[model samples]
Target: MSHEYYRRGKNWFTAIGLLFCVMGGIVLIQQLLIWGIDFVEDFLFNAEFTNEKVSVAMLCFGIFMIALGFRKHEEKR
Candidate 1:
C-alpha cells in the first residue's frame, strides 16, 4: 500500500511538471516571437514602447504554471 502511494505521488509530479513544460514551450515560443516582432518594428521606425510587456507576460505565465503545479501537488497531499 505504501509503495503504491509513493508510485502515485511520483506519477503526479511527473504529470504536473510535464504539463507545465508542454504549455510553457508553446507560451515561451509566442513570447519570443513577440519580442522579435516588437524589436523589428521598433528598430525599423524608432518606436518606443513598454519593453517589459513581453517579460511581464512571461512571468505571469510562469506563475500560472506554478499555480497549476501546486494544485496538483495539493491534490495528492
Candidate 2:
C-alpha cells in the first residue's frame, strides 16, 4: 500500500491527534502493567488496588480523535 497515512498534513490536527493516540496508548499499557502488578500484590500480600477505567476511556477517545483527524486526509485525496 501507499504511505499516505504517514504523509504530513497542512493542518495541526493530524500531528496532535497522532500524538494523543500514542500518549493514550502508552498510558493504557502502563495501566495494564500496574494492574498486573496489583494483581500480583493481591495474590501474594493481600493488597487490593486496581482501576483502569479512566485510562481505558481516554485510549478510546484518543482513537476516535485519531480517526477524526484522518478524515481530513481522506478528504484531500
Candidate 3:
C-alpha cells in the first residue's frame, strides 16, 4: 500500500490527539467565570473580554492548539 494508506491508523490517532489539544486550549474559555474571563457578560454586556489582553490570550491559545493539531497530523505522515 502507499504511504498515505499506511498512515491511516496514525491519522486516526492524530485526530484523537487534536481533540485533546482543543479541549486543553479551551479550558480557559470554560473556566471563564472563575477566572473573570467570561466572554458573554464581559464581552457583550460589560465589554470585558473585548480588551486586547483577553483577545490576544484567546487568540494565542486557539492558534497554538490548532498548530499542535496540524503538527500531530503531520507526525503521522
In candidate 2 the C-alpha lDDT for residue 54 amounts to 46
lDDT of 3 by residue, 1-77 (tens): 76554343444434655565566456545556455655445553563445434544655565655565455334332
Per-model TM-score versus the true fold: 0.34, 0.47, 0.32
Off by over 4 Å in 3: 5-50, 72-77
Give the Cα lDDT of each candidate: 0.52, 0.59, 0.51
- As a whole number from 0 to 100, the lDDT of residue 72 in candidate 3 is 33
Candidate 2 ranges beyond 4 A from true positions = 1-8, 37-51, 72-77
Q: Sorted by TM-score, highest first, which candidate order results?
A: 2, 1, 3
So what's the TM-score on candidate 1?
Answer: 0.34
**Candidate 3, residue 50: lDDT:** 54
lDDT of 3: 0.51
